[model samples]
Target: MPPNTTSLIQPLDQGIIRTAKAHYRTQVMRKMLQAINDGTSIINYAKSIDILKALYMLKRAWFLVSPATIENCFRKAGFPVIDKTSNVNEMQMVLDVSEFGEAIQEEDFEAFVDCDKEAECFGNLTDDEICDSVKLNRQGMADLEEEDEEEAGISYESIPGVSHKDALMHLSMVRKYLEENFTEYNSYYDIEEMIEKNALINRTQSKITDFFK
Candidate 1:
């Protein structure tokens, strides 16, 4: 059965989720080749994949939908055919798509992101877990220091004027929850990209995992 256009709007489209997962791996390679740029890329990559997988799982539709489906949808809608592939560091493979393929371009965000639909849950976790996950959110520094004994049990609401970085991380977590559980997802780049491009949570991947649990 052909997929429904409305179904494509789900928070994390299976197709994109698959692409993002691959993208994360590619990024890991890129960072490694760059003389091991830093200690945080690995963490970001892991969180990103977690995010991609979580979102993809929500779709419950893997390779079931193809890039061609999206292309056809665009062609029929009069959008220009933009051929591209995953963007890594400097080295990227560019493939032209005349025969229906998947090459998630940055511009794709314009069409795929339905602000209303973009707000899906990526991680359907409990409030306590959500609060704990905040520590992992990139706040422009490594989450290496000891948690203040008193601040450990606080919820997002309890905190006042959390730093912009913390807000971004918490929101990322919230977005993950909404994407995984809700019916809409509007982000083109996975939460990982959001973290790297605009971050405040600079903690280890293991820390992020331990935190939520």
Candidate 2:
């Protein structure tokens, strides 16, 4: 499939990603508010967000997406539910951006929800500015070693800068940590636990905060 077609497929463009983005922005906004409340500059927190931390927030936001929401996304893409237990309107196939506005409560949420406004924001940048902001490697790997040579170079021995045994041991430790923390209760009584514990905590916090407001 072409890139455009693939992007338009069942789940990718089916409002799932937009919802996740909104959730992520909401978290960022919350952090900004917290920094303000603490008499600290929001720029510090924004600039200090490393890629790993950003990815963690995104993953957590995605984890909050409900099964029903995902099913609605599939149905929006014209895929009929297999069980046929619910009725979905054909007219409501695609979701509107405004539908996710509730996820973000900041004043700039409207600007974030506006697709044209976002495009306009980025469209003002010059070609050089855009290129400098983005890194692109267009060179082909023509001089790369052949598959046979690559396979022949495989080694498990320790080197000056790297030790394969230590690497494997570190990976094993990470696996153990994840097994104990994240995936430990993933399968309860042979049935997969859909909602994560952290997500439940977040929902509870959100509710408590909203109740007092």
TM-score of each: 0.22, 0.44
Residue 110's lDDT within candidate 2 is 42
* Span of ten consecutive residues with least summed lDDT in model 1: 89-98
Global fold similarity of model 2 (TM-score): 0.44
Question: Model 1, range 41-103, lDDT digits (tens) per residue?
Answer: 655655445455655544543343355544544443455667534222211121212222233
Please identify model 1 stretches exceeding 4 Å from their true place: 1-11, 36-143, 146-213
Distance (Å) between predicted and true CA of 67, model 2? 1.5
Q: After superposition, how far is residue 146 of candidate 2 from its true place, in Å?
A: 34
* lDDT score, candidate 1: 0.46
Q: Compose the digit string of candidate 2's lDDT tens values, residues 80-199.
A: 787555443321322333543454444457455444423422235689876865543222222232443466685334226534445555656666777788856433423222223333
Residue 117, candidate 2: how far off, in angstroms?
A: 8.8
Of candidate 2, the 10-residue stretch with the lowest lDDT total is: 136-145
Runs off by more than 4 Å, candidate 2: 6-9, 83-107, 113-213
